[model samples]
Target: MRTACFIDGYNVFYGLVAGTSFKWLNLPSLIQHIVHVEAPESQLTSIDFFTSGVKPSLASRGSQSKEAQDTYLRALIAKGVVVHYGRHQLEARNAPRFISKQSPPSRLDQVAIWKLEEKETDVHIAISMYRLASRQASLPAEERVQQLVLVSADTDMTPALKAIKEDFPDLRLGVILPHREGTKRTTPGSLKNHSHWMRRLVTTEELAAHQLPERVPTKKRPAIKPEYW
Candidate 1:
């Protein structure tokens, strides 16, 4: 089976890599491993990774964070992954101040804050997936992507999955939630409903084994792993 994978980069980072030692992940290796395990007949043909550039001012590690992201993105490109860039928008907005979890938020008690949103990523992923499905519909059976795998836990993608399932019954759909081992997270029912199969958790051993080399070569220079990572 010919397969193509779509990745929601922010979702995977927050769900699996945040506060973890697996920052230097080799995305293609990991996804290919998962695909082979789930369906041995699958031959992963392409990967499209959607992400926004990191804002240095908003990052915990400031400039270092941005630099790390740039390096990592370069490495991914060098390894044949197609990257789609979105953008971060920081705006001032009003929202209810959180007092306690027991107390419901009231609009009367509002505070002004800077809201940073990663724009266009979700829309981009959705449109890209649907577009791929549409294109595949016209291709010869041997050239078409028989399976489409999504590497995300975000429920926002449910609608897109639904459309593909409805319009292209012959195309196989799969979801791989970016939840890590030892973490307890509810399975997204909507995504599961649309997918032919779903893989709920990624093990630490799998992550460790699929990490990129300490230095990844690019056309200009070698992308080195950040020391803090």
Candidate 2:
């Protein structure tokens, strides 16, 4: 069966950026890397990476950091990963250092921003799952893709996960989480029992060799490597 990989760009970023030398990752090559490690010689259809474009309101972290991010993202596109850029709307975060019920709290002059729901990223993942599932359903019985691999830690995807199974009984559905070794839940036999599915946190070793030789690749992985998709 034809197989495709769908990645939650932020989920992946949060999962891997902890220890890798490079902050950004190569989406398409990362898939090939994972496939080579887990199921070498298998057919790979396409790599879809869903990420938000830089917000116009993005606070400047100065020039050097921004340049690095731009360079890394560009490299990913150059390598063939489909990049989906979306807009960001920052939400208010309650600073722990200060608080109030009715009166205003003191400003420490420290500014911070966060989003409870990164709406764009969530929408992209949901939309992709639906679009691909629908597209597969529209194909001829024998020509349709029956394998989907999703990489994310968002609980938002659980509904989509269940729906895919019911809608496409013949299709194989799998979930891959990006987290460090000690960060994951204690293994259930299912994760171990699942022959065609799994949950993995990204490892530093994999991060170092984002795009590398398929056979006998360098094993000089990082010391605090985290497991990955």
lDDT of 2 by residue, 1-229 (tens): 5677788877776676644544545556666666655655445677777876444345344454445445555555555567777656678875534345775666664356675445677767767876788798678886777677777776767667667666767777666677755565443333333326765665666666664222221223212211221
Q: What TM-score do all the candidates reach, one by one?
A: 0.97, 0.69
User: Would you list the C-alpha lDDT of every candidate in the order shown?
Assistant: 0.94, 0.61
- Model 1, which residues run further than 4 Å from truth? none
**lDDT tens digits, residue span 50-143, model 1:** 9999999989999999999999999999999999999999999999999999999999999999999999998899999999999986788879
Residue-pair clashes per candidate: 0, 10
